[model samples]
Target: MDVAEYTPQELARLQLGFIIREQPQQNADHSGTHASSRKRELQRGQQKARQEMLDDLGVEA
Candidate 1:
């Protein structure tokens, strides 16, 4: 199914999946700076997806 067919919960689940998939590997000894940057990126993506989902559902801020 297309994105337009997905419910808000489904959209959220998909966004969560994306964030999880994008997470840095546990075995990697990345510095705090890199880790924080990656985390910020994922958070931004989640926020954007949530906003889009809310918009699709005709929800107001």
Candidate 2:
């Protein structure tokens, strides 16, 4: 748990691999309509962001 022990590259690798997901309770829509849409949207956003980061790092995904 001591991040200080990790080098910058190691820390960045860990950070980039971490994903924060939204809880079902976070969305008031229990009907599975808006929530699914939002989830897909968020996933696409994450994928785009990750691709951008990988591109910047010159790493192939």
Candidate 3:
């Protein structure tokens, strides 16, 4: 899947637990799942939602 087609929320949602630990290959570094651990959990939920949406479209996360 094209990463550029993903929404900001979808992209941000993917970088949950390993924020600074995971570096973007080509894009600029993004500060996602920051602030607190709960934020990461929330992002996980968002990721789940996005995944479900993709699944409905016959795409797997």
Candidate 4:
């Protein structure tokens, strides 16, 4: 049987195990990556958000 056929209990167990194994390796950055990298990321996110809002309002940025 495929792993996707696993029962809910089994799937939950697998997910919990994966999180436990990976959590410690996860990034703890308040921003993300290095300082310069984070600035670009924030800028991109802000620009995207503004564009989305403008699109909803039928306006161009």
Candidate 5:
């Protein structure tokens, strides 16, 4: 086995992530819990980003 087989791009992918449709379907119930959680996370991130922009503009959150 060679320790020098890794490249920067390959290492980045190892730290990266992606959604698998099958796994969520198999694991989560039919209530779409995983999706709702992801959506909530996304919304929170967006809200935080928007708040940052508003703060920069001296606007109220």
Candidate 6:
């Protein structure tokens, strides 16, 4: 689906799904430190995207 056609709630849901999907696995061991850090960063970005979507909807976060 086109992002421009999504409602704020739909965008937020999509972002949340991304966050969930990208979450670091507890048993992840390859690239140990760097992978964990990168995962953390990506999760933070997903959270920010979700917040932005909520803000666009004028939701009091």
lDDT of 4 by residue, 1-61 (tens): 8997996655655655555455445545443457557455555655565566588789966
7-53: candidate 2 lDDT, tens digit per residue: 77666555544432444556655747777786777667667767876
Candidate 4: global Cα-lDDT? 0.59
Clashing pairs in 3: none
Give per-residue lDDT, candidate 2, residue 45.
63
lDDT of 3 by residue, 1-61 (tens): 9999988766765664355344343124544454445455556676677777798789856
The ten-residue window of minimal lDDT in model 6 covers 22-31
Clash-forming residue pairs, model 5: none
lDDT of 1 by residue, 22-49 (tens): 5667416765877778677777777787
RMSD of each: 5.0, 5.0, 8.1, 12.4, 9.8, 4.4
Query: What ranking of all candidate models by lDDT puts the best one first?
Result: 1, 6, 2, 3, 4, 5
Lowest-scoring 10 consecutive residues by lDDT in candidate 5?
12-21
* lDDT of candidates 1 onward, in order: 0.74, 0.65, 0.60, 0.59, 0.55, 0.72
lDDT against true structure, model 5? 0.55
Of candidate 3, the 10-residue stretch with the lowest lDDT total is 20-29
Q: Once superposed on the true structure, which residue ranges of model 2 sit more than 4 Å away at CA?
A: 1-20, 27-29
Ranking by TM-score: 6, 2, 1, 5, 4, 3
Candidate 1 matches the true fold with a TM-score of 0.55
Candidate 4 regions off by >4 Å? 1-33
User: How far off is residue 6 in model 5, in Å?
Assistant: 35
Q: After superposition, how far is residue 26 of candidate 2 from its true place, in Å?
A: 2.5
Cα deviation of 57 in candidate 1 (Å)?
0.3
Q: Between which residue pairs do clashes occur in model 6?
A: none
lDDT (tens digit, per residue) of candidate 6 on 9-41:
677777667666755554255657776787777
Cα lDDT for residue 4, candidate 4: 75
The local lDDT score (0 to 100) that residue 45 gets in candidate 3 is 70
